[model samples]
Target: MRTVPKSYYKHFSNSEQIDFQKQSSLITLPQPRAHPFVPKDHPFFVRTDLTAHEMGPPKTVRTISQEAFDEVVKENMEDLGMEPTEALQDAIQTLSLQGVDLSGIVKCVPGESSLKDNPLIQSLERLKQLDLNSKDKFSDEDLNEMMGLFDKLIELCGGNEGSVNAAVATKNGGVELVCSICYKMRCGSKRVLDSCLKTMALLVHDVQSTETFRTGGGPKLLVNILIDGNEDPEILNSGFAVVAASATGNEVVKESYMELKIDELILEILSRQRNDSIQSLYDAIRVLLTPDDDQVVASQVYGYARRFAKIGIARALVHSLHAGLSSPSLISASIALKAVAVNDEICKSVAENGGIDALLRCIDDSGLQGNKTVARICCSLLSKLAGSDSNKSAIIENGGMDKLIVVSARFSDDASVLQEVMSIITVLSLRSPENAARAMEAGSGDLAIQAMLKFPNAQQLQRSSCFMIRNLVARNPENSFCSVMVSRNLSDRQRRTTKSARMQPLMH
Candidate 1:
C-alpha cells in the first residue's frame, strides 16, 4: 500500500468548495467536436458505474484507536501538509471508512447535540435543500457524493491489509462506476466531455490493481487527465500511474495510446524526474519498449537517457557494469548492466565524456568475475569508438593495449566476449601493424586469435595478424613476417644439405 501524506487526503477531501466541481459536468461546447469527457460517470452522462459497489456489507471494519487516529490526523496536517482544522475535516472523511467518522459516532450517542455533532454532513444535506429553494445553484449533495468516493479509495488502500486487496478487486472489476457518477453530474449533455473527468479523477486517485493501474487501459484515462493540464497533484499522480501501466501492455495497449502522442508525456515523466532511480528508469524503459512506435520509443529514451546521459547518468550505469564484472552476484549485476546497455547512446556519450577511463577504473578495482567481463565490454566499446586510424591509435595510447590484454586473458569463458576483445585489438593493430606485432609478442598469439575466430565473430577482428604483417613488411622488407617465415624454411633446407654432404663423404 502506498501511504499518501495525510495532507494529500486532508486538503483534497475537504476545502474544495461545492462550486469547485459545480459547473455542470457540462462541456463548454458540443457535437461538431467530440465530447472531451473521458468517462461516462452518470446514467445520463457516460453510464460507467462499474466501480460503484451496491451499498453492501462493510465487507471489513476497524474502529481506529485514538492514537492511530491522532497519527493519521498528524500526518494529514503535517505530512499531507494541511492545516489542523482542514486536516480534521480530511481525517473525518478518511476515518469514515472504518465506520468511525467522529461526527457519525458522536451523534450516534443518544441525545448528543445534533447541532455540533455531524455538522459537516448536516450542513451539506441542508445546503442541498437551500439550493432546491434558492433556484439553480450547484447541489451540495453532488460535492458530498464526490467526497464519499474519495473516502472509499483512501480506506481501500489505507485499510487493514486483508481488506485492501478486496478494494483493489472491486476497483479493477467495476471501475466504470465513477464514469456513471460523472455522467450524472454532466446532466446528459452532448457537449459534456470534460465533465467525465470528475469521475476519472476519483479513479486515478482511488484505483490500485492486482498488478498495477498500468495494466488494461486504465492509463489512457490518466493520460487524458494529464493532457488537460490544470490538474491537481492527485490528478497528476494518477497520470504517473498511467505512464507506469503502459509498460505492461501488448500492441493493442500501445495502439490505444498512440493517438495520444504518448511520447510527450514520457518526455515529461523522464526529463521532469518523475521516475529517477535506476529501478524507476528500468520500469520506464519496460513500458517504452512495449510501444513499437519508433517515435515514442526514441522520444522516451531521449526524454530520460539523453537528458542525463550527458550528465552523470551513464557513469552510474557503467559503474554497475564495472562493479558487476567482479561481483559474485551475477544475477543482480547482470540485470543492471543490461539496463545500461538498452541505449547505445549511453556508450557513445560515455566515450565523449571520458567514460572509458571511469570504466577502466572499475576493471582495475573489481574483485573477480565482474572485472574480466567489464574489461571485455570496455575493449569492445573502445574498438567501436575507434572509428578511424587516429581513433584506434588514440585508444592504443589511452591504455587500450593493457586493458585488451586483461580482458582477453581473463574473460576466456565466453566466445562472444573474447571475440569482442579480439576485434578491439584488431582495430588497434590495423591503425598500425607495429602495434599488432607488439601485442602478439606480448602473449596474445595467432593461436589466441584463432581461438576467438568464428563465423559469428565480428568480421572486423578476423585479420589482426594480417594488419600487423602488412605493417611489419612496411617496417622492414628484409625482415617482414612473411619473409621471416621464408628465412626459417631456408635454414632447415641448408641443414639437410649439410647432412647429405657428410653422407657422400662417408660413402667415398
Candidate 2:
C-alpha cells in the first residue's frame, strides 16, 4: 500500500522500474524521526535561522590522560599498520597538541629472537642512527623507547643491584653504544646529548656493565662532557649522576675515576657560582668516598681522598655547607670529611683549610632544627679532625667545643652521636690542661659517666667515655673531675679504658 512520488518512476521503463523497486525493497533505510523540522544533510535537508554567535563562548578543551592517550594511539597505530616505536612517536605528537609535556616519556622496555633482533637492543641501535639535529631528537617516542630498553635490560639483570654480564653487554654492542653517545656529546647537540647522557646514567648501573663502560672510555667521555658542557647544568648534572652510579661500591671503577682527575673537575665546579649542580656534585663526591671493606679498595679510596684534599675538597664542602645547612649536601660533605679524616695527615690538612670552622657552623645551624644526621656527621668530622693536637687547638679556637658539648647534650639519647661527642672531648682533653679544664666546665665528666651508665653494653661508648674521664683526671686533677670520679668511687679498671678495655663494676 506504498504510494510513490510521481517523478520517481517517470525516467524508467516498466521492467526496469519493477527491478529497481525490488532492489529498493531489499535495502534497509533509517526510520524517519517524527519531527516538525527536517534533519541536516538529509535528502530533504533544511537550515536553521540561528547564527553561530548565538552560542556562548567556546568549550574549554580538557587534557588527555596518559592512559587514554596510549589507548587511542594503540588503536590508531593498528589501523595505520604501524610498529611500536612509530606508534609511540605518533602518540607523542598527538599528546603534544593537547599541551602535554612528554619529555619524561622516553623511559623504555621489551623481548627477543636474537640479540640484535631483540626489540629493546634494536631500539637502541635505531636510536643511534637518528641525526642529532633531526626533529626526532626531541621526540618523546625515541626517549621512551631508549629508556624502555634500559628498563628491560635492568629487568633482565633482575634489578638495579643485579649484575649484567660484560660479555652480554659487549655482544649486544653496549660498548659501541657508549662510543656513539660520546660522539653525540662532542657534536654539541645539547638537547640530543642530554638524552644520551641519561642513557649512559641508566646503563652503567650494574657491576660488570660499569666495568665495561669504564673500559669503553665512558668515564673519560663523561668528564669531557662535564668539562665541555660546563655551563650546561643539565649535562653536568647527568654527567655527575653517571659518575655516582658507575662508581658506587665499584673499586675498579673508582680507581679509573681517580686517574681521570675527576676530583679536580668536581672541585672546580663546586668552586663556581653553581646552585643547581650542588646535589649531583655532592652525590658524586659521596660515592667517590665510599668506604670499601676490601683492603685493596680501601687503600685506593684513602689515596683518592688525599688527592681530594689536595684539590681543595674541604673548602668546596665548606662553601656548600654554608649555602644550605639542612641540605643533603651538608650531610654528604660532612661524611666525606669524616672519611678523609682517617688519615692523620688529611686531618691536619682539613684543619688548615678551615674545616673546623665549617663543622662548627653546620653543627650550630643543623642543631636549631634538630637535624641529628647532619649534626652527627658534623660531630664525627670534628672528632676525626681532633685526632691531631694542632687540629684540636684549631677546633677549640673555632668555638668547636661549645657546639660539640651542646650538641652532645641535645642528642645524648642517641648512643652513636654521644660516642662521637665523647671521642672528641677525649682527644681535646689530651691536647692540654686548658682543654681538660674546659671539659670539666662543660660537665664533660658527668656526660661521659651518664653515657657509660646508660650504654653499658656499647663498648665504643664506654671506652670513649672512660678515656674522656681518664684524660680529664690525668691531665687536670685540680679541675675537679678527679675529685668527682673519686667521690663516685670509680675503679682503676673502670678508669683505665681503651678501645679493647673490658667493662667491670664501677662502684667497687
Consecutive 10-residue window with the lowest summed lDDT within model 1: 499-508
Cα deviation at 8, candidate 2, in Å, is 88
Model 2 C-alpha lDDT per residue in residues 1-508, reported as the tens digit of each score: 1222233333345765565445433322233444443232122111223233432233223333334445644543455444555555555553443234443122121111223554445555665555343432335565455555555544543344333332344445655675564665464557656766665666665555677787777777777878898887888887787889888757878887888888888888877844644466777887887764253523467677777877788666766655557455677667766755557777877766667777788788767778788777777777777878888788877777777778877887888889878777877877477987887887776787777767778877877676666677664548553545534654555544432212221210
Q: Candidate 1's residue-wise lDDT over 420-480, tens digit each?
A: 6656555555535466566655554532434423332434333333333333334333323
After best superposition, candidate 1 residue 491: deviation in angstroms?
26
RMSD of 1: 23.4
Question: What stretches of model 1 exceed 4 Å from their correct place?
Answer: 1-277, 280-349, 366-384, 387-394, 429-438, 446-508
lDDT of 1 at 413: 60
* Per-candidate alpha-carbon RMSD to the true structure: 23.4, 21.4
Question: Top TM-score: which candidate number?
Answer: 2
lDDT of each: 0.41, 0.62
**What is the alpha-carbon lDDT for the whole of candidate 2?**
0.62
Residue 298 of model 2, lDDT score:
37
